[model samples]
Target chain A: MTKRSYMAVPFVLGALLLILTGYWGYTQNESRKNLQTNLGNRYQMAFLDLSTHVEKLQVLLAKGLVSSSPEQDLVIFSDIRNEATSAQGDLGQLPLANPALTRTNQYLSQVGDFAYTLNKQRARGKAPTDEDWDKLAQLQEQAGALNQELKKMEVTVADGAFNWGEFRREANEELAVKGRKRGQINLVKLERNMEQFPVLIYDGPFSDHLERVKPRGIKGKVVSREKARNIALQFVDKGEEKWQAVYRGKVNGKIPAHRIEVKPTGAAGVFADISIQGGKIIWFLNPRTVDKENLTMEQARQKAANFLTSRGYGKMAPTYSVKQQNIAYFSFAYLQDNVLVYPDLIKVRVALDNGQILGIEAMGYLMSHAPRKIPEAKVSREQARTMIHPRLDVQAARMVIIPTETLKEIFCYEFKVMLNGQQFLIYINALTGQQEKILEVIDTPNGTLTM
Target chain B: MKKRIGIIITGLALGLLISFGVWQNQEVTAISQSLYWGSKGPNVVQLQQKLKDWGFYRGKADGVYGADTFAAVKKFQQRKGIKADGVAGPGTLKALGLWTAETRTTARKPGTSRGVSNRGDITLLARVIQGEAGAEPYIGKVAVGAVILNRTESGKFPDSLNGVIFQPLAFESVSNGLVWRHTPSADSLKAAQDAINGYDPTQGALFFWNPAKPVSRWIWSRTISTRIGKHVFGN
Candidate 1:
């Protein structure tokens, strides 16, 4: 070979060696990582499995105790014994270098022996005698106690609560000395601490609190306006000394109305005014209540939700809007979009028992809901009239203007209905040609009907 | 010349063989360590055997590692009334048998009867009924529960009672793990079994909700009947 070629050969050979070594190293490292991860997952899963089994066995034992089902007790005991054996066999494969776990395993074996004997006897048609039950119960209690103790140990290990090496050494020391004498710690407390988190409570829209605080009298026996005002004041102040009442008024006759005023103790000029008519809230007058600049949609939503939930109307969802001045306002419905949250009337027909809320038609919620865009007219009032049963006598038929609850628009529609005999209401989807909703009314008192 | 050629070839072959042997040995070592540390292979195999022994898992222990093993594991979990995930995690292993050596004493703690677990089961069943047959009576709820249980019995759903309960939005409570919160009352269990036996008061209803309130329009397309609670039941 040429001298230069001979020299190049060694360089090429060295490069090849480097590449091969690097590839092998990478493969080995990757393999080790994968193995370690799999092993960790397996161990964790195994531990959890063991925990669940113990939990079930405990539950079964409890059932047996309550029902005094010796058969169930026997089954539980046998199952537990079998589980304990299987777990031990699985754990043998794990390299649980921790001494606490090792000691725990040993105790587990002792418990297993106790359970196995009881189960074996029970399976042989010998029900756990009272004495046997007592022994089993004691074992169960001890097992639960030990589990708590071990779990604490596990947390410490998993959370790196202590140095593993030192903790292991200490555990080993504890095991070697008092070993079985290690008493159970209060695990409930530990778990509680571990699980504790935080929640936020608000103190705004204070006027709405009246809705929650005021007690309702049966249907509409005249409610004292004075009582209602005091309740509203109490709600707005939330019993805060810093708040002072400013103004109150009543506008009434057709739709009864009330106006109320309040002033903050320290603030000047700024005040709150509210109005209610026919026992329904009409308007709220707090400049701060309307968010101008620094408010987010989420904040507005939360405020609305808070207002509704606090008012005992926990289910109502409110919509928010920005007024002309860029101030945000909130409004909700007794009947939400296409859904009758609060029915004006609920009619039920009971067949079985006293009665059930068989048929509930919320005409008020439907009529009072937000208007929807008019659906395409398919069947005119004349066509709808044809579909009605001839046997059903028509009392009233008119083309009156009504708001569309589903479409959120205004429309002219027809109401051709009768309340003469078997109560039924036929609603025509004037926008669409289809029958919107048919409600069969039941003739029964509100109190008499089972809800 | 021929002898020299043979010698060079033999040396090359020996080097190649050594390299291949080392590579194979490394792979074997990796696999063994993985098994030692708690690989699925070992855990799954052990769980399958335990379930078969317990009569919950009937699939052959071929060790191919698939859904059958999961189903068997789940069945064992359901019968034991444990939360079922087919993998033989520590919980499954412990349930199948007991672990005595690590931290807690290896003895199987006799299970406790928490008055709470039973009550919790009632709530879960109530929630399931509400979801399945809110408008229907006890019969409707019972039928829905039975359908869920039937799915468990057949190969279609996760076999464990919990697996069936908690099979991702299959039943709302099951998805939320609220099924675990419930203690299965004898009545509820009976109802579930009854529904599984093809006695559908709902006549194979897969969905139900209050008719007084607005439901998804899709529900209208299905043949709907049988109103209970506040909902309409349908297949």
Candidate 2:
């Protein structure tokens, strides 16, 4: 009878255990479903908001296309701008893959910027041209198409026939299959139906024609990437018998160049921006701190000038020197006929412990180094000296090609003076006798910065 | 319970009276001698100048301390929320920017102090102020001093007073033999003191330079925070 009771007890315990496990699992599944529903609701809201914004943007663009009054035009254009902006913001909030949305996003951003530019021009009492109106019409059509696509997707989502979970999972899996690295998970594939979505070209900031200034100083036979890498290796190569340079591709900027990163064996080296045409080293940097400083600023300055001279930079004069921690940096502008050419600037950073060249940048030299007619100062130093305040005790003076606040180059008489016993540099416009600017030579604990 | 409450009240009253005595003792510096109706000599002349500059006195330069000067002193003292006893005392003088030697918060003894380090950070501050902003307006000098102080607080820069001052490629004065050889002048020391005391005219500038220099492309890329004197302060 006791054995029979034991068997019944086991049976009862087994049933209870099975029921508990099933209940726990059901609760967990229910909570997970609840969370997913919450996520889906958020995505649906974003999608709905996105389509609504895009539809409004299309309507505003249509209004902009026909508006004749500059006052009404300004108002319509501003609305179009705000609508496009909010549409982009709504699109950004959605976790949609960007690959499908990059060009579309760009199109919206440009439309906004274009509208902004038109509004500004109208506000300035200028009339919009025929091309601008045509562009606005074209923008309205493209926005309508994008709106249609978003609306269709919204409908499918609302019907519960489409699954966002599956779409997101598939996109991630697609990225993995394609072997795309970091940040690619956020990219979703859009329906590929943009065959002739006109690459909108306008006078806005997003315009493709923004940077057309060819490299002014990069003049020589065009070299291949391999040759450019070889030049960089030779230029930075010192003491190390074997040094390899990694070729990072071209810089997609106003003046494109090949980027080469060099790391010597067991020591960090500098990056070199070599021109594709001349293969000149435009810039270099290796910020490995030299913890022990044995050399002073004078010694470091001499070492930097020597390094540049060895690298075929002819007759460079030290313009400024600053030392911080155990490193010293020197700016050396090219010298022609005992006159310092400030535009052709070359910067050198020296590790002061052993005076090793840590970095060298010559972007100014490489980009603005073409032979120029250095203009003679219209105002003589003596005449300019007379214009300064009586409290300014003149020290040294030079004729420098100083850049105006507007970034335009102008010849000026640069004068160094002591005011109230503090050193100051004053630049007077050589032609106009106008005091262009004054710089107080500020001394700090480690280095000095002119303020 | 009633006895304990009475005891507590009596103890509190005694404590408050003793503390008040201590506070009064501190406030009564002997140099703050109360002056009235009839005083004379150099101290009066100094007091008269301060009151006149602060728009309290309209009298001409005179060696004697008179009724007009006394009245002006009283008015100035009253305006500054001090005892209107017509005394050119330590507290009142300090308020008028005519602080005396015996009662000066900024009368830091001239020495190499390690406020943050043994490398003479205070001296270095003074030297840099003298070297860089020696001729700048007093406020501008303070702004220049605060820039380095701000740098020491940032994660990108060195954390110590010595590290910020002696950082390589940082100060032209350091490299160009200005800071190392500079002797801190009176104004420079005061500027450094003001800056150390948290008077930042730069509004937390990490970098400053004249807009006239061939400033690097990287420096120009920094967002400007404020402009003081000829220097553009940037963060």
DockQ of model 2 vs. true complex: 0.01
Model 1: per-residue lDDT, tens digit, A203-297? Answer: 21111121122212112434355644553454341323465554444432112334444446665312211223224332222322212345454
Q: In order, what fnat does every candidate score? A: 0.00, 0.00
Query: How much native contact recovery, as a fraction, does model 1 achieve?
Result: 0.00
Q: What is the TM-score of chain B in candidate 2?
A: 0.49
lDDT of 2 by residue, A1-451 (tens): 3556555655655565565557556766876788777766776676678789899998888888877997899889999888887776655545432233545666777788789889877876889999988888888998888877777666676776655555544443444223332322222223334435876777665553432334567888887889988888888735545778888666433335677777776655456667777788766555454679788888888888889889998688887665645667677888776666777777787888988886676655765677667766677778898889987799999877754322246677888999777888888888878787788775546554454
lDDT, each prediction: 0.42, 0.66
Worst ten in a row by lDDT for model 2 chain B: B109-118
- lDDT digits (tens) for residues B68-170 of candidate 1: 6667666777777777665555555666553322332222111111011122333444456554554443444565764454343332223334444543234
Any runs in candidate 1 off by more than 4 Å, and if so which? A1-6, A97-103, A119-134, A149-451, B1-235
* Angstrom error at residue A259, model 2: 6.7
